[model samples]
Target: MGFTTRPELRGTFGAVSSTHWLASAVGMSILEKGHTAFDAAVAAGFVLQVVEPHLNGPGGEVPIIVTPAGADEPIVISGQGPSPAKATIAYFRKLGLDIIPGTGLLPACVPGAFGAWLTLLRDHGSAELEEVLAPAIHYAENGHPLVPRIANTIATMRELFTTHWPSSADVYLPNGEAPEAGKLFRNPQIAALYGRILEEAKTAPSREARINAALDFWYRGPVAERIEEFCATESVWDVSGRHHKGLLTADDMAAFKPEIEKPVSVAYGEYQVFKCGAWSQGPVLLQMLQLLADTEIARLDPLSPDFVHLAVESAKLAMADREAWYGDSPEVPLGTLLSSSYAAERRALIGETASMEVRPGSPDGRRPILPPLMEVGTIPQPGLGGGEPTVARDRQLPNDSQGEPSLNKEGAQRGDTCQVSAVDRWGNMVSATPSGGWLQSSPVIPGLGFSLTTRGQMFWLEEGLNSSLKPRVRPRTTLTPSTVHRGGVPYLAFGTPGGDQQDQWQLLMLLRHIHGGMNLQEAIDAPAFHTDHLPSSFWPREISFGSVTLEARFPGETVEELRRRGHVVTVGDPWSEGRLSAVAREMDRGSQIIKAGANPRGMQGYAVAR
Candidate 1:
């Protein structure tokens, strides 16, 4: 759960709120500016940097997967930066530092989320950076109401926020206290930063230069110098005077470059799965879908007890694999795990009987068992099945022509991340997930809208692990932005920022809507079950089974049945559930039905649509 819930906006366009009001405001502004969904999403990311500074900023990194309408090749963007040549395993070994517990500026990676936006502009946007960034600029200058979620998170982590950066304490802790919700929060410093970007863009001839100028201001220019000077005097980087690289230098800031990459996609029945490469846990999501396809899930009823049971079981299985083999592929053969043959073999292991025992199995390829479709009540369509029949559309993205395998998966963490989805009248769509790691780990630069990331905490300190934080190695991440298409047209835009929980939440939503035929809200609202069948990024060895929790919601007998299968069961409270925000578009007849949902777990979320 990163930011706020999904806001409902009508107009054939929608935006899900993040933790920051400025992020939402910027999202709405992007829509007003006539940018596509992707453009607005990128703008939201930029704006969120200002309002929610501790999580992520212009200098932060993000990994992405984007699929355009009617296009076969899915565009992948890696917002990650290479490890500085100064970093090495030996470098840490000499300092006797094996693990850095989730905090400190030294752990910041080269920020690439800004670069990811540039990639989107090159491939998808038509507007200039100023237009895309107008909303954030306005909010930064004019100020916005501090929503409940932002206020709460700030209050909860006030110590961390103030301790990380003195400027953050000055801004977030106005009046020497965290403001309550509905209070007018203002940040003229961030506003000035935006004003500068807009002023520079007016004269900047090339789109690239305009975007670069904005980015440069955050890093190598005045911002970077201020941050360096502040850290030098504040003593924030002193880890007992060892492993202190002081503040991120101007050279580090100037050297940051985002990467454009080809995404890895795999077919699963009538639909296809697309994911960011090994640089993130995105591949784990697709692989889970592949394993699920081998089961009887695709054919199951949307809301039946059996359907829920099987889906939960399949999720646990997929999580198992994710925990085992997913990581930075640059140093390993992570892409081989996605081969069709490998998926088929894993599918064969799905036992009809429920089993508590779950393990990451050996890789094998085999054709999957055809699953049975469930009989759920549905409105009859013209010349379709009588009952509430499933809407099975025939559309699939073509595989990459070249056999170059997908690589790269490294660190990602959830501090405060939000996603936005928009679809204009022209059938253009956007899916974007903007993130900031936890507040205790990093600080927002003075007057900047966004914060530098604490992404380094997402990596493991243990050697021989996929998520291990090696010197000069990027970490695998879990921030994923996804788009779903039907009838060769973009229909759904969704993303989540729940750390490792992100993929599971997204997969459940996709499966329920695409295969199970649940409405957007229903899919998001359904009770969730997580699996610890694999190695969790945080936990070395653990697998959570949905059967255990599903049974808790139901009769005691169901739990008994799951227990018989050998699952370790632990029941949790109904409150404090994970949050999910998603937007979807469906065409019924000639009109469009645009729907969005925010997780019920939070108090602040609004969906505005006309």
Candidate 2:
């Protein structure tokens, strides 16, 4: 694999899949315009929406963790749109509509990304929206090179796009086909939208007024109405207004607010661990670290048999806890899961050798363990004749006449997400995993320039489980944005997108670097393993360790040892679809060195630190 790593020369560092050049140019623009870390991230996110709309958009929810200098409290922003006030648990059950799919308006969460950007700018930004958004506006109006990856993805998904969204096809496919690599791609419609925001910002008297104006432009005025009209015509709108109002009415859009809450923190050895709440999978990272800390990992040779065995064992234990206990805290004991006693108890289970079978435990609960949701007794008819019922469960392979499982079946499609990280000149670090659920419905909306997320597809219709995606309920998501700190200072900012494999990939990288004493890039470059045993977004336990290697890297004895431990292991593609982006900074006394790492699996990312 031709892997590349570079030092970010400017004060800021950023990476986006498929367009490192575009990301770098935008980051430079933010710095040249004198924006803070938060401001630049918000700016970069907006631009990425225009360029990489397949992953996220201005209409999406954005979860952010920001640490500022000299401040005891880190600024945490929750860019989540709420379930419409009318939405209730009873609503989904009544319609017999419970399966979660990655399409339609079902997964829309009040479009928190824009709200988050507005919040960041209102509080901490040095420049106005016009200056921060100038790069994206310019790119949209003029154009940027159409990279091969983007062009190919567009071509591959074209049929789905044309079938589901005629309007989206009009813009993305300019000449009966997706644009080719190096072709200058432009969106005059999105450019016009940006122009409107700027024009409104100029007329506003106060900063808050200007921000509100931009928010209103998208949420309340012509834009909001257009969204509603599309949903209504498509008949995707729930007429009862029981679930979140379709396409957001003026009231729904106007009433939406961004949440700022203190991050849940735990002591992972000497360093304090912080993460976005259980509404996301952020807490899993901390749990994995804490579990590893309780083990004698530092005593073992870095890649020796003894070390890899313990590391994998520790990871499984931690993942078990995550599967059971990590979820939305509003209805669950989120804080309790992060408690010291909880971490210690979970950690105490790791053994130097391996345990064959993974012990299944129920999640900590206020209620007795609820049975898995009832299987659909009958297949309800789709509201639209052409569409099918959106079921979130992994489809099982059919059984043969002899009652053995058949391998001819395939899985449902999921969307790709973007993760970015940066370490500034003064050593302030920021990491964000902003993603959209698979672009279930393509050509999402005309002139919108992107697809709507099928995030709703991640939820279940079941009554009691953590994976339940009821009305007004947030589904269990894998978008975890994390920062690792050592000795009371930020050290690493990293995140990845691989559905359920995200946590496993990140956990291994952290241990390799921190406990195994490898450099940042080395940790990322090292061969890694992921399991499919647990309830990740997908199924059949995708054990990727052996699937990637043609040559035997581990000793035959080590492979035998792992088998004795009961892993249904497979050597996997080293550059499996999982893509992790990271920027690590080592600071001693007054000096600091920052190193960035990008997976070699994809060609469109880079790392730079001055």
Among all windows of ten consecutive residues in candidate 1, which has the lowest summed lDDT?
Answer: 395-404
Give all candidate RMSDs, comma-separated: 12.6, 6.2
Off by over 4 Å in 2: 1-19, 85-90, 94-98, 236-248, 300-323, 348-414, 437-443, 465-467, 470-473, 538-560, 584-592
Q: What is the TM-score of each candidate against the true structure?
A: 0.78, 0.82
User: TM-score for model 2?
Assistant: 0.82
lDDT of 2 at 346: 65
lDDT of 1 by residue, 510-560 (tens): 887777666666666665544434333421112233333331334455555
**Global lDDT for candidate 2?**
0.57
User: Measured by C-alpha RMSD in angstroms, how accurate is candidate 2?
Assistant: 6.2
